[model samples]
Target: MAFHEMLAPDYIFESSWEVCNKVGGIYTVLSTRVRTLLNLFKKDKIFFIGPFLHKKESNIEFIESETILDSWRKYANEQEGLKVRVGYWNIPGKPITILVDFLPFYEEKDIIYFQMWEKYHIDSTVAYGDYDDSCMFAYATSKVIESLYHFLQLQGKKVIAHLNEWMLGMAVLYIHKYLPTVATLFTTHATSIGRSICANNKPLYGQLSNYNGDQMASELNIKGKHTLEKLAAFYANCFTTVSEITGKECTQLLEKKPDIIIPNGFDSDFVPKGKMFETKKVKARSVLINVIQKLIGLSIPENAFLLATAGRYEYKNKGIDVFIETIYRLKKTYFDRPIIAFVLVPACLQGARADLKERLENAVSSQFPLPRPFITHELVGPLCNDPICEYLYYLNFTNEDDSQVKIIFVPSYLNGEDGIFNMVYYDLLIGMDLTVFPSYYEPWGYTPLESIAFHIPTITTNLTGFGIWAKSKGAKSDTLDLGVAVVERTDDNYFETAEAIKNIIVKYITKYDSSQILNIQRTSCALSKKAFWSHFIKYYLQAYDVALRKL
Candidate 1:
């Protein structure tokens, strides 16, 4: 069958734990894709369902809309005792949203789990932590969908309930059992087994083909979550993944092949351009330099290169180890300019350091180093326990008087209120001369894409989906000539990966001229254009088509 001939959904409903909640990369996927979806479907035809929390305590990303779905809202409340708030997401799309209050469903948790086991074989009896909360919310979302389908009296209209990640996979099973006519699509951003294996220091990519997912899940004590995910993938009308790399992981780890690959894409509407971009970059650099100077008590060189690596604090999975190794190697090389690297990954921080705050407020520049000179915030635990800090201490890159390479750990979320920089992540990201994310287990790296979106060249390993995509489009690994360096990496090639990154940084600092650097920056921006949602939304349409056809 021709791809274009597939049926299109009249009403599309997307459910996720990250919806209206900025937790991780899946939030980026759903929020960024909204504008494109809004353009295709009517504003009322699209709905994003998420768990509702108290408005005062939650960082709510939704604006309540009482009039939009008033009729269905009343019907659901009166008939099914379903409590939901209709709203518009405060994003580029401003699409209609339904935040369901799942607290009422807590009493029915055991019954819901039993039904799940009987209908779909999802075992949640041994589930703990986020299992109960996510399942309750998913159950609430399913009720909301059923109410809407009935209230609207649309028995035959094409509808899609797309659930993202394992947290929301219960909704797919719910729809499969109750509303069989509603086409269901489940997208597992990353399999539980795959991530667990990586976190446990197991060789995932190297031994992927040989490993039995169920055996690994049982061994890792993640069988419950893995079973739920596996069943969702098996039962969904169309099972999709965010990247080709994750597609392979899903096939092996979940025991199911993805119906289609819907790669994550960036929306460039948030990025600044022209003189505005330059102005933001200047402000960002000033903020970064000021904070570092206050903490380390030394004014860095004017031409010092600013670099960073930011994401969830997954040391090995995100390649913080290799990043530190590369920085250590770069310190021993003969480079004239100083390099200041920021490890922007959030960790357990006890607010900003009192001494650092006092220095920033007083604008004092003391010659003596602070207690922990390289770390910006006071850790909640012993400083010796942090892998990145411990590794830096082991390597002796402690921002000493004679050290050319300075590493500062900003272990707080950059939400314009990190006390020191007082700048959001994107604000600080634009000031970077380069970014490095040589990840060992990245599905679709958003940091490198965000770097290139800001027109900063980056170094990432081919193990990442973005790196492979960039290489297929003629990206070079050893040079910043093509904007992104795609380093070849494997389970056993840790030192080689580190050495490759070190060589690239050395080349950029020693060989590239000012004009050449400008060219690389421009090339990075051009490559980012290829990843815009305008170009990648077709893959999602394909997935939607497959789901509808399955109905």
Candidate 2:
């Protein structure tokens, strides 16, 4: 399709911390939604820019080929003082991508910070840790955009710079200031100060209305990121967030209302079909059971209920604390069926547990449980520092021969070679009967959506973006018959939410009606199909239109 005939911007340039790097949920959003975006524009029109972290080596997800813009690449490399790898992302859409080496920017980042402070009043005086590196990357990405824009002579074209997260907030400000013709869409997945508040164990929901973002940032020592996010949200041609919940967060915390609310959509291709699906599911189950039996030294029955809660290890913010409480509450109940709940949250792991590896190697269930039997891998840090393991220790899980519930904390990433489990996240995800993501401060609950996508019923709280979307679509907010149960989570309703989850699981387990369960699973798959990028891509197009018109 010709540029004039198409409804999309002439070129769509998107930058994220997770473009090629699989850091978090943002990777899921961009990588999965590429196919849908490509349908609107040609492969070259939609450009994704990210950091080059693979040390000049070829990344499995990136295919570096001869440049379509070789002249510009050469000029930018030598003349424009930029370093980038021109490539196509090896994903479903195989879209064009540019992974930039931003390390050189570190030397000039202080000067760049001064410029930002002068131009946008972004405070970076007290920034620490990953702040400098991320800011340098964002600034470098913007410079890359600027150089490419001038080189391509895309001055009068309807171009968009869709920058994601606070990490890319600098890019938004830079494009908005330097390239006025190109519209900028800044999306804050979660406000920095808001997340900091929750991560610091402060009561966010109840005190949100009374809280000032600047004051909280000062109190929490996150003024640099918070200020950049706030100003970016204010000055961008269009500000977008992932969900209604996160949009409200931006309004309250960042003090700028989002122009569009685009929910993250799933890729249907990730799911297998027919015999392949069943085969993977069976293998997943067998692996899960084998790991559990080996770790706990007990024969797990075929009817074991495999429940899990997997994501970043934010014990309170991700409601991992609540998940543990739910398990604790459920264990007190007298359910006849055995429960195998796995905590798949990756952390700073030393490696797979030596004792567990020995048991698995022998392919035999232990006659007795080993020490610290609840975890698959040992942590690099002390047990007291880890909220999950510390809390599990407090709960005193025996993992005995006749225990009702066996909790295994796999504190390592499931990349098909996590020493134990030996399967990737989705492979293990498929075998689960139920999943929970009762997040206290989730921008978008991709874990729960992924669970439902794989036909496993999930229980997520209304606080999440996905949970609110599920509620709006009328997915039995607190029932299992429809596959997803959105539990009502509140600041003070910690016990209530745990009780609700415990009740839901108990009922589902006791129902023992295979036909109804199968119906729920089918309904889950059907619901996920509705949330495919093909359906959700329209909202992105709407955001693009909003940004283009603003210019």
Candidate 3:
């Protein structure tokens, strides 16, 4: 079917945030689908509803008419109105309108806490409830839906409320009790239990830390999760997840399977593709190379291999520590032939920064330490002095432009400054020899999938969404294959990650001639075409069918 042929009924997806206010992969999933969604559902049929937390202008106005608002306010006041006026307003976008609710959290500031803990790219020493936060969260969820319900009632349009993840799933359960025929569709991008277990193999809090399967199933109210998800699985009109791997995980973990697997795709309008690269921005390329030199304080030879890696901070989970260690290991073997390894993973907290600093220090001292003066300045001087070092310094060190290869950490919850950093990352992506992401807990990573779409080779582990999807398409090997190199995530030390990076560097930057580079690019583009728009959109159509049949 043509891209325009797929249609999903008036689909209204609600989450804590979306692209304009992204904090995780969820934002990437929503934003990348904008073009495809517009083509599928057309205008008005698709709407994204989230809390209004930033510098957003609210134009669509509605008076709070529901008694539920009064009930929410009374409850809020009783709990001291923890969240600051979050009212709802509609923002116009092509193919869909975004309805944002901001009244419940009008004057509050605890968003920093949630953003730091759940969405912030940095690590923190602070605990989750250093302040009273639950009431406010419950309030935000309730009020947003309460406000959204009245707004949709005003529009007189029937909606299939598509709630993503557990927080929004809670809202769906509450909303469904009142409006049973609303045709709700619940999607668990990743189950809470599954993610928490994946992240640390323990419960999020110590309260349920010791509980085994049955005890955990009962103690922290697993029934509540099972109840919500099962209701969605068996009771809701339809259910979906971002990828088939994640969908399967949700079913097995939640004990309730989704009806469809809506794998994510890139927003071709934003990310560069095959023909897009042929129209390269030469100035953008030069600006990036300059930035790289400034960052490392070493000028690199023009022919020196440049490899890049980046993602939100989940350093261990995203396999960044392994990436760094790999570079350290490879540098030992290829010291004579310099290669610039650009690290671009974000760190969420001061603690995470210190931790990364310590790791980098250990790597430097063990492998690349200077002969004289232990101080940071003294050590970097020799690195800046060599003629080959002169090339490295200018190209990798002095080039502060993010487009070039340099270890650049982009922070979480991108706002004014960070948004520019994100754009730079996109620009830098074009110049990369390869991009590596070996995530241990990614439900469906957008990075590897996006890298291929951009015609850049990538490395993703089986633990990621795209890796499993690639395997589905017959991709194999621990080396450079399938336009992606799949590194198995195991108890085996960091050597596997290091080996994969070394192979990619050898295949793309070190060993390959222009003809070989062109072949890799062609393979990447072909793989992208396989994922392009067909496979994912068909799942959406199937979901619509399931939803309509149930309705």
Candidate No. with top TM-score? 1
Query: Model 3, 290-405: lDDT tens per residue?
Result: 44333344455555555666777665667766666565455435333446666555433222223223434343323222221111111123444433233333433332323233
Better of 2 and 3 by TM-score: 2
**Model 1 TM-score (2 dp):** 0.97
Candidate with the larger TM-score of 1 and 3: 1
Sorted on lDDT, best first, the list reads 1, 2, 3
lDDT of 3: 0.53
What is the lDDT of every predicted structure here?
Answer: 0.88, 0.87, 0.53
TM-score of each: 0.97, 0.97, 0.69
Candidate 2, lDDT over the whole model: 0.87
Clashes of each: 0, 0, 44
Q: What is the lDDT of residue 62 in candidate 3?
A: 19
Q: In candidate 3, how many Å is residue 302 off?
A: 2.4
